[model samples]
Target: MSQISVVFHSGYGHTKKVAQSIAQGATAQLIEIDNDGEISEQDWETLNQSDAIIFGSPTYMGGPSWQFKKFTDATSKIWYNRGWQDKLFGGFSVSASLNGDKQVTLILLQTLASQHGGLWVSLGQLPSSSTAATRNDYNSLGGSVGVLVQVPSDADADAIPSGDLKTAEAYGKRMLDIVNRFKK
Candidate 1:
């Protein structure tokens, strides 16, 4: 079996819920960046030891939250040494708007993984875009790079759509499968 880790920062609890759903499906460890945009040294060890790492962050101001960015910046040491090279990587982003420029956040994550010479995993799920498709359907937001979750701005974290959570779970499963397939 391969070990996977989900490292993320949740500003308003919404992203944390999404990370939990993905972790459930991936059977992965969760490393949360605290409100101060810092994670423990143990969290860094977990990430370094993980066979696969999935990054999650809520999109704020059309990009990943500053907390997540701080975490990303802190990974420079690992990046410089190519510590994550050849590791499998995945990412997800959450936002309150249906088209909240979530793709930009995902690209930031993908690029970060690429910078460390890690393999990027695409969402790989076809979108639900038909006229009959509803918000409760998987990939209703039609994301291709990675998982995209949208919660209404007025709604609480608990009000996240079921479809988005399920999509996150499925993506977790996909990442696990890929990790196992490429395991040494």
Candidate 2:
């Protein structure tokens, strides 16, 4: 079986919901980056053992939260040893607005993954850009690098749109599929 890990930081709980949906679909484990911007030692081990790592964070000020960035910085130990080299990577992000500069956050993620010498898994699903597309549509955000979502600033985790969660699930499954196929 493919071992996938979603290691994320959720500031207001909204990103946690997105991460949960993705994990459910990918059968991936959740490794949370806590409020202090730290993950446990075991979580670090899990990350090293994972076949794929899906990075997640809530976009803040047009970028990943400083907590997630802190985690990224701590990866220097792994980066020096190329511990994650060739490991598959995917990313997802959520923000309060529709165009919350999600692309920049995703780009930062991809850059981080590349710095670790990891392979990236694209979203691989067609975007929902047609006029007929609804809020319930898949990939409505048209993020090819990974899943991206938007929730109102006032919305709670449970209030996240069903469509965005669905889109996350699809990306998770697709990621797992690719990992399984390439494992042999």
Each prediction's RMSD to truth: 0.8, 0.7
Tens digits of lDDT, candidate 2, 45-89: 999999999999999998999999999999999999999999999
All candidates' TM-scores?
A: 0.98, 0.98
Candidate 1 per-residue C-alpha lDDT over 1-184 given as tens digits, one digit per residue, 9 for 90 to 100: 7999999999889999999988988999999999999999999999999999999999999899999999999999999999999999999999988989999999999999999999999999999999999989999999999999999878888899999999999999999989989984
Best by lDDT: 1
Local error of candidate 1 at 121, Å?
0.5
Stretches of candidate 2 off by over 4 Å are none
Query: CA lDDT, every prediction?
Result: 0.94, 0.93
Q: For model 1, state the Cα shift of residue 42 in Å.
A: 0.8
lDDT agreement of model 2 with the native: 0.93
What is the C-alpha local distance difference test score of candidate 1?
Answer: 0.94
